[model samples]
Target: MDKIISNKEKSYLAVTLSGDNDKEVIKQMASALEEEGYVKDTFADAIVKRESIYPTGLPVGEINVAIPHTDPEHVNNAAVCLGILDKPVTFNVMGMEGETTEVSLLFMLSIKHKEDQMGMLQKLISLCQDQNTLKEILAKDQDKINEVMTALVEK
Candidate 1:
């Protein structure tokens, strides 16, 4: 398993996602990571199950997003799959049961080390809090997305 954090070419940035539901979207992202050797074959199922119990959907200032991930046992390497959905999909809001959000961005994290997971989530949450940066990410293309992700992780 290769570390994709520092390698721009290996960045798993999906320019467009067509999944109509959260499960479908997560499966698509997990499948991509699995193909790149970042995660095990069981990653998709694990993440889907985890998501149901502890949702990752965050309602940022303007744009809602999700950070879906599973245990380190299901991951072979540390990587993130940034999925930009073509249309918003419904996802249960984190820490808010019975409430849902329409998320257009999904950040599927596959972190091999448990210690690194919170650090990565902090960076992503920081990025989410910054409306300007989030807007820039949404406006940018695949290459630019890679740069943004690389810079964020490196920080």
Candidate 2:
């Protein structure tokens, strides 16, 4: 599975973030990936810029989530970060032009290839849409979240 979840001291896969705004949240996620060498230093800025244009927020079932990512050029290693916010932050809705939603969970992706990016996106969106899965994820700690996501990634 290529260790899709990181186990470094500053865990990247599943962690609680307390960024007060969308930009801050995205930056925090990017910083964690960068710290682990999963992404280039440019990743943080790139993702922030990308999110401004193509918002990835979705209001699925009960909870709202966001999937923020950037071009493959900014990624050094492919990995997904799951950030559970202490409080929800407002994010622009995907394809909804000017609409927005409050997102409490975020999946920040660092994909090294465009093709893989699409596949991962599809899988993540599908997983996020399941209310039960989302609830389970939110209820667990970092280690358990890693188990859940690792299982999901392997599938």
Candidate 3:
């Protein structure tokens, strides 16, 4: 994991059953942010490119999690956006998960320091054990997903 941003500080949480590839999913999240004026069109394309060759999917030993991201030069502001998938989205893994896994969440990170998020990333990985919390967020509709995301900030 490069570095994971605070789930609380993360503003956008989109519950999407996106396309198969990591780059495709990155495009989905990045396009939404771009439409929201958080990033440029070329920036989104750059993000997809960064994620294409250098995979950001983290293997949990059993399954995988997609951490699609790019250089801060692609983003207009410092923020984090998430895309949760109930149906698995196939993305490449960095570890020995062999091939790939059905990713449940897309923790699309937009950060300043590409690697300084080590501590926060560690914290996020630790929090992954909270299955109930994860389930609640994953099971939400679009409106409820926003609420759940906003609640993280309140806490």
Candidate 4:
């Protein structure tokens, strides 16, 4: 499989955020992504709408995670923006109506190509499923997180 995340892209991984809710967190992350030139300004609203309609929350063992993404039109470049929230935020679980999950980690995908989405998503799911990897991601510094994530994508 092709490498899903690049070293330059890994620099976009953020360690923490102060958002109190999903919308707030997404907005903040999207804005940061825009500033980094990874996404267009419209990405924030597009992702929020996508999340509301098709939530990305996944229950991965002890920690809940969310992968929020939108159509390729809103992307300036391809990169994964990782955000670890200070507190868990509620998000509706994928494929489950009316049920929600408390999410602490957010993976905001800015992909310029539509075809690469599924492959990258599958890798992300794999990463989430590994407890050891998740622990490393949650506890590591930005550089270490980038190293771990880069290694995962290259595998």
Candidate 5:
């Protein structure tokens, strides 16, 4: 798996902005993931199941996002897919605040090894703290996304 925290996207992750429903988003993410050989169809169920129990939304000021995912079993390879909605999508928040809000960012996480997963969420947490990176992403194009990935990895 390419280092998501480092912003090294090995290739294009084919994410989509479709319907407003959670299932629809999951399906879109899973299809892109499977197409990239990161996961099997089972990953859709894994993501949904994970979200059904605990929501994945993380809030940081105006940047509300979701990182819906499951364990390593569903992944054939390891990668992260980013899906940006035309309009902010709503979902239940993951933390203690537990509020529901529109999500502008979506990160589908998959890890082949559990050990590699340890610092990832924490890395994301810190990255989210960097307002400049978040601003750049919110306004970046796909090519820019790729560039951001490169910059992230070099750091």
Candidate 6:
């Protein structure tokens, strides 16, 4: 796989929201990305809209994860902002409406090019499917998380 995410891009890793729900968590993550200049001012609202229409939640191994992203027009740069929720939040399963999963991880993608989204998503799915890899990611600190994710995306 090509390295779609660089170390600077992976620098947005965070552990967030034990007390908040899915919408709140998404807002928080979007705020961070926006502050970092990875996304545009309208990014948060766009993310909410996109996720509402096409939920990104997926059941990967024993853990549930979400890959929330909006159209490239809402992005200023390319990056992957990761959030590890302190507790699981419910997100409707992707491709399966009326069903939900408790999502603990979020991969908020900020890609400036529409063409790169699917490729980035494929690499993310590959990373999410590995139980050992997810465990390693969950156990690491922010710096370590960046290292782990960068390695995974690069490979």
lDDT of 5 by residue, 1-155 (tens): 12222232563352447557766787787877786677887998889888878888877768777878789999997777777665677788886555787777677777777876656666666666766666667664556667644443232
RMSD of each: 3.7, 4.2, 5.8, 4.8, 4.5, 4.9
Runs of candidate 6 exceeding 4 Å displacement: 1-12, 141-144, 152-155
Q: Candidate 6 lDDT, tens digit per residue, 61-87? A: 677899999998898887777777777
Ranking by TM-score: 2, 1, 4, 6, 5, 3
Please, what is the whole-model Cα lDDT of each candidate in the order they appear?
A: 0.80, 0.81, 0.60, 0.78, 0.68, 0.76
Provide the lDDT at 56 for model 3: 65
Q: Provide the lowest-lDDT 10-residue window in model 5.
A: 1-10
Mind giving the per-residue lDDT tens digits that candidate 1 earns over 16-53? 57787999988888887888788999999999999999
- Residues 46-132 of candidate 4: C-alpha lDDT, one tens digit per residue: 999999999999988777899999999999878777777777889899999999999977888888889889988988897888777
lDDT of 2 by residue, 7-94 (tens): 5543346667887799998998898888888899999999999999999999886779999999999998777788888788999999
TM-score of 5: 0.81
Query: Model 4: residues >4 Å from true position, as ranges?
Result: 1-11, 152-155
For model 2, where is the 10-residue window of minimal lDDT? 1-10
Model 3 lDDT per residue over 1-155, tens place? 11122233454545364565666667777776676566667777887777667666765633346777677777775555667654667776655444666777766666555565664456456545556656665665455555544543331
Worst 10 residues of 4 by lDDT: 1-10
Estimated TM-score per prediction?
0.88, 0.88, 0.71, 0.88, 0.81, 0.86
Q: State the displacement of the C-alpha of residue 104, model 2, in Å, after optimal TM-score superposition.
A: 0.8
Clashes of 1: 0
Better of 3 and 4 by lDDT: 4
